[model samples]
Target: MDTHSRSFAKALSWRATGTIDTMIISLVITGSIKLAAAIGATEVVTKSLLYYLHERAWLKIPYGRKTAS
Candidate 1:
């Protein structure tokens, strides 16, 4: 099983990549750096929490995992 800290770290790293993508898309559509940054900032918090929860939940599932006899 993955540790809580490890899950948290993974969430953060994943969020960093997602945030950048969101900001780029926001900037392209809105043509405003400030707006893009605001969108990215909010996404960072909300999505990070969501991702962490999702990761933890997946750890409880028994699908596709190998076990030693």
Candidate 2:
């Protein structure tokens, strides 16, 4: 495969593994908290990006949280 394709494949594999791990962790945490379903990769990535921007002061308004302070 080409370099870009290889890189993308590697990223995909890594993301898949991370998703699985996140799912398992989410399952445990949610079970403890009595939450419903385990969040997926999309949600985790989106939340992380939002938090990064928030920490950078780029996102002043809360994106996912119930209250924005």
Once superposed on the true structure, which residue ranges of model 2 sit more than 4 Å away at CA? 32-38, 43-69
Task: Please report the candidate that would top lDDT against the real structure.
Answer: 1
Ten-residue region with minimum lDDT total, candidate 1: 60-69
Q: Cα lDDT of all candidates, in order?
A: 0.98, 0.54
Model 1 TM-score on a 0 to 1 scale = 0.96
Candidate 2 per-residue C-alpha lDDT over 9-67 given as tens digits, one digit per residue, 9 for 90 to 100: 55556656766677778777676422323466465566555544444452344566565
List TM-scores for all candidates, in order.
0.96, 0.47
Report residue 13 deviation for candidate 1 (angstroms). Answer: 0.4
